[model samples]
Target: AVNLAIAFAMQGHENKVGLLDADLHGPCVPTMLGMQDQKLKVGPIGAFPALGPLGVKVVSMAFVLAGKEVPVVWRGPLKMRAIEQFLSEIAWGELDFLLIDLPPGTGDEPLSVLKLLPEMDGVIIVTIPSEVSQNVVGKAITFAKQLNVPVIGIVENMSGFVCPDCGKETHIFMKGGGKKIAQEYSVPFLGSIPLDPRVCEASDMGHPFIMEYSDSPASKAFMIIVKKIKAFISERQS
Candidate 1:
């Protein structure tokens, strides 16, 4: 996966796109984008790669501490600096959308983002379609609401699976869990994605779902969600 989900994001628009991996604890975008071997240089000017796409840029802790399994193990201040470096020092280059993959939960990352960009467009929450997953996301939603950050919508991943033999729908994780949360929050329910083996297969092969299996239901779901995201954001900007 070339992270074209980030690429598809800029489709038909002449705007800038920034894919920020705020998941300090488990920053996987580097591995996901196949840029894990690349090193990032931090200079007095700022921290950024010397080469990449024009409008599309990525920054993540995975880039900073590449090939290392050491935990960040920092307090709020260190996390704050990392977030600051990502936003202020990095050459974001006039982004229209900064898709931040925040570390799960209502911890330092989300708080730092809220503090850094008080007028942020909003957050797109991701969760598996399960009661336990929804419960945890609900807590995050509560924190966001308390801090006054509107949730653009919820992206339901791993909603259900299809039986290859009989071609019947299986409620692997049960269904409608994401809609329940969206209804509770009064935010738009973007869409649901199935547990396609191709999704995991593509990721293992270093290809994102949108790239490998664009015709898959999961990819179709993402396309719809992307449109909803664009519309929701446009409304917010207006």
Candidate 2:
């Protein structure tokens, strides 16, 4: 989800984007964006986010940890305080959009960020096409609605897999769960992203899949969803 958001923000030269990795327990933005070894600089005001590709500023717990194996074993209050600091102390300058990547489920981290950014545009729920994912994602939607945060839409990741040899599309996790959930909840079904192995390869290499494999099915689906997100934002503003 974070990678896709970065790709969407980098689509246009005028788009200034920032990404906050609020998944305190398992922050992956630093590693995925290839800034794991980079540390945040303490300036006059606060910590500055590391510069990423396309000039996307990013902040993650991975940047603060002494080592990759370091663990964050704190209570709810500590976690909430950390999130607050990330929002208030991080030097996130003017941005067209700031995407906060929350840990999955309606947990303390996600709730804290939502409360801190009440005026946030909305949330783009990402889930795989499965009964379990659909069930858990339902709670996510409810959480956002209860907090008065609009749900932008749902993006079904790993919706299906395309065979490399036969060129056949396989329903690896079964299909249509995302759209079904959207319909049942009366929310928008943005689009579906097929399960492409190249996505994993790109992540392991610290490269954005959309940039490396723009011709892949998953990348194509991602751009389609990105368009829907922009349209949704425009409609809301208008």
Best by lDDT: 2
Clashing pairs in 1: 1-206, 1-207, 1-208
Q: Model 1 off-target regions past 4 Å?
A: 1-4, 13-15, 42-44, 49-55
Task: Evaluate model 1: give its TM-score.
Answer: 0.89
**What clash pairs does model 2 have?**
none
> Where does candidate 2 stray beyond 4 Å?
13-15
lDDT of 1 by residue, 1-238 (tens): 1333444543653336678788888877766655676677777778774233333467878787736687888888899888888888886666676777787788898899988988888887888888889778889788878888888888788888898789998888888989999998787788898888877676666555575666777877877788888888789889
Q: Candidate 2, residues 1-238: lDDT per residue as tens digits?
A: 5567666665783247888898898988877777789998899989998888788888888888899999999988999999899889988888877888888899899899888889888998988888878889999999999999999999888888878999898899998999999998999999998888877777877887887877777778888887888889889999
Which candidate has the highest TM-score of all?
Answer: 2
- Predictions in order: lDDT: 0.75, 0.85
Instruction: Score candidate 2 by TM-score against the native.
Output: 0.96
lDDT: worst 10-residue window of model 1: 1-10
